[model samples]
Target: MTDLRELQFYATPEHPCSYLPRRQAKTLFVDPSAELDQCNYSLLSDLGFRRSGPHIYRPHCEGCSACISARIPVNLFRPNRGQRRVLRRNQDLEMRISEPHFSEELYQLYRRYITARHADGDMYPPSPEQFDSFLIRSNHHTRFYQLHHHERLVAVAVMDQLDQGLSAIYTFFEPEMAHRSLGQYAILRQIEITREHNHPFLYLGYWIRGCQKMAYKTNYRPIQLLINGQWVHCGD
Candidate 1:
């Protein structure tokens, strides 16, 4: 295991909170110049850190501690009725995994997802450059999984295959297919994929309490939340 304490971290200046309004947010990131790899990523993730593009970061707010790292202990996760419905709903689609690469098909789906779902957010004006930089270009460990329906791409899930588990970086799906609930379905499939690789956990990134956007993550039972620098069951 890497001794993350010995590594340098750079904290960003205060910025507007993305989840909670009327608040400021700060983040601590692993120094970009550091020798980051799968091993370091695993340790950092275990320590409540997460990756965005190529930079690993975590909430470092001065006066608040609402953003907590969350993960599913895959072995103990049992899909609730809604999740099981998602599984059955997407069962007709084919799942394909590929190394990170940019394509018009994926870009189109991403654009639709952002425009309809996050038009009010920072990534509202999504572009090819941003997509390439954020999802395509990364450490060689990144993988892109696609859900296809009759040979047409419907969703894309970006994940980082770390030493101990898979980190779900991002996921985008056809906005018109909201009835299928592809977002939650993708995570369920990811949990199965991680289990197939013998990985013990599926890092779902930060889950901020009282943030409606993060409420769905709690649907996955037996989740671990980083509290006071230690991993513990959320129910506890």
Candidate 2:
């Protein structure tokens, strides 16, 4: 077993905050040389660290604590009327789980999604290299949940299977099908999948209180937020 205390961590110099404007942000990263296995990765996740490609990191900004890690206690989650509508609207989509790999079909969808949805973000002007590095690169625990509608592939949710739960790494979908609410649907599916595997939680990454992009995470009621080094239930 890897001793948590033995792991080396380094903090990056403050950079502009991605979620909030004007404020700066700093990130604490686990040693890149450190070998990460499912055991250690899961342990790190419990401490609010998130994986970005091969690197594990957590927000360590000074004088700011807006980036809160959020997770859903799967068994305690109850979909509200809006979420139920999202599920019903996406009932036609079929989810296929597979190992991570590079494919043109997947790449094109990702490009289109990024182009249409996140063009102003850092991930704008997407490239195959960026796509490969971000999503294709993974450890043994990673899985891609591809959502299909008939013969058309609509969305992909990249996830990591951990000892106690599943972490949603990232998700991208057809921007034109915004009415289907694919992003919310993907998360609901992840919660179902977590339950199917008998996992206790579904890690939803960071939730910034005022960030519009992150507001949807709160919709998953009964979420637990990692606050002051403890996971506290944030009730609906």
Predicted candidate 1 versus true structure: per-residue lDDT over 118-177, tens digit per residue = 998889899999998888878639889999999999999999988888999999999999
Best by TM-score: 2
The lDDT values for all models are 0.89, 0.93
Listed per model in order, the count of residue pairs whose N, CA or C atoms clash below 3 Å is 0, 0
Candidate 2, 1-236: lDDT as tens digits = 56788999999999989889999999999998887789999999999999888789999999999999999999999999999999999999998989999899999999999999888888999999998888887764899999999989999999999999999999999999989999999999999999999999999999999899899999999999999999999996
RMSD of each: 1.5, 0.9
Winner by lDDT: 2
**In model 2, which range of ten residues has the least summed lDDT?**
132-141
Model 1 poorest 10 in a row by lDDT: 1-10
> In candidate 2, residue 32 scores what lDDT?
85
Q: Candidate 1's error at 65, in angstroms?
A: 0.8
